[model samples]
Target: MTKESPLKTLIGLAQDDVDTAAQRLGRLQRERGEAEAQLQALITYRDEYHARFTESARAGMAAGSVRNFQAFIDTLDAAIGQQQRMLEQADARLEAAKPEWRRQKQKLGSYEVLQARSEATEARKSARREQRDADEHAARVLRMRASNP
Candidate 1:
């Protein structure tokens, strides 16, 4: 059995690492998107709630009710801020994974290039060996014919 090329093995391992990094990056991106969507939904709800409060105030809302709406809106704003921070963290992680993936991909490419060069070198050596053998056989045949004649 032919031995496996070490460079090929290194390439395979690097490819796997790159694939894993890509998957991680995809997950982080999805998480960031979900967080953004949630933040938007919360903002929308907060706007709609404030609009309702405004309408109620125009119609002369009770003092206690106005205080409660203000408190809840404050809480929503805090939650939105927290979600934004979470999304930022996720973005950072995804951004970090991108560089790791690129590095692995570059490593794999280098290994592939090395393997190609090695294969080409082996092919050239084999062709040279075959040509030398053919030449020797031809010389032997000519020598034999000349001696016989």
Candidate 2:
């Protein structure tokens, strides 16, 4: 079996790291989006509960069924409180993830930049070596012509 070149191995490792980081970043973004959606849904539920409680109170005054209506309203209020707490927790998680996501993205960018610079440096070095060889060939040709003439 042919062994892989060290440079190729290093490049492969770097590429793997980049791919892993990208996947992790994508997952974090998806999680954040899901968290936001859940929070929005909870807020909607909370609003619906509040509206129902208000209507129930108005109906209770007209129908003289205050006790049962108040109990229902209290239950809805408790549900709304629970949902609000959940929404706040989701928001907090999203906030905590933001900085970590940014840092990972920055790390990926820096790795790409370093790879590009290394490629450019290698190209420049190769070009310089080729130029030096061409110059030596020209000098040898000049010496041959001078010696023969």
Candidate 3:
């Protein structure tokens, strides 16, 4: 059975935490992107509706028609209302996700720091062990030579 050093184990745990945090961050980013796209689409739809409404009104005025202009105005208002609601929802979602994303980023930073510390500790331990072994071997060689002389 192979035993793992405590520092190595800690480093592994930290890395796993970092990976998880990164995944969460990525998910949040994707969500934000989707929300932004949806918001932009809604804005585009609103603009198109506005343009149609204006054109309809102008045509109705030229033809002395009332019903078409009224209908276009109603449609434009409804579309604008829907777009406003969607924009509000998107903004809320984005605001809510921002804090969570920030927290995940902070957690990733902490994990990285922990991993770095663990690695440094492990490296120091390895160097110390190597130095101790070398010192022991030199001491043994000196004893053997003195005994032989």
Candidate 4:
């Protein structure tokens, strides 16, 4: 088996880091999406409840019923505000994860570049050795011909 280059090992590790970062970024994005969906759902529910309350009031609701509706609507409004804050926090976390993932990707790319350059250098060296061997063999064959003749 060929010995592994140290650079190859470093590159592999860097790639793993990049993969981990990407996964984390994906998770963060999913969480952000979920939070946003929840926020939207809360907003929709609040709007629907408010509309129902308005309809009841127009249809001659009792004073007690109006107060109850107002109180419940106020509670829903508070919950919606809380959910909006949670969504904002999720967005912030997703934004923070993005730069770290990008940094990992850049690091992996740099390691890959080093590996490529190392391979190229080895190829050049091998080619030079092969050329030198061919030239020596040709000279030896000519010398033998001259001596035998």
Candidate number with greatest TM-score? 4
Model 4 spans > 4 angstroms off: none
- What would the per-residue lDDT of candidate 2 be over residues 26-138, giving only the tens digit for each residue? 67667667766765776677578668767867665654456666676677677667766765776676666666666656666666676788789999999999999999999
lDDT of 2 at 40: 70
Candidate 2 residue 69 C-alpha distance from true site, Å: 2.1
Looking at candidate 1, the ten consecutive residues that score lowest on lDDT are: 3-12
Clashing pairs in 4: none
Pairs in steric clash, model 1: none
Clashing pairs in 2: none
Error of 1 at 62 (Å): 1.2
lDDT value, residue 81 of candidate 4: 89
Best-to-worst TM-score order: 4, 1, 2, 3
TM-score of model 1 relative to the true fold? 0.88
lDDT of 3 at 6: 66
The local lDDT score (0 to 100) that residue 84 gets in candidate 2 is: 65
Best by lDDT: 4
What range of 10 consecutive residues in model 4 has the weakest lDDT sum?
50-59
- For residues 1-149, write the lDDT of model 1, one tens digit per residue: 99877787888898898889888888988998998898899899999988988988998978899889989999999999998898898888888888888888888888888889999999999999999999999999999999999
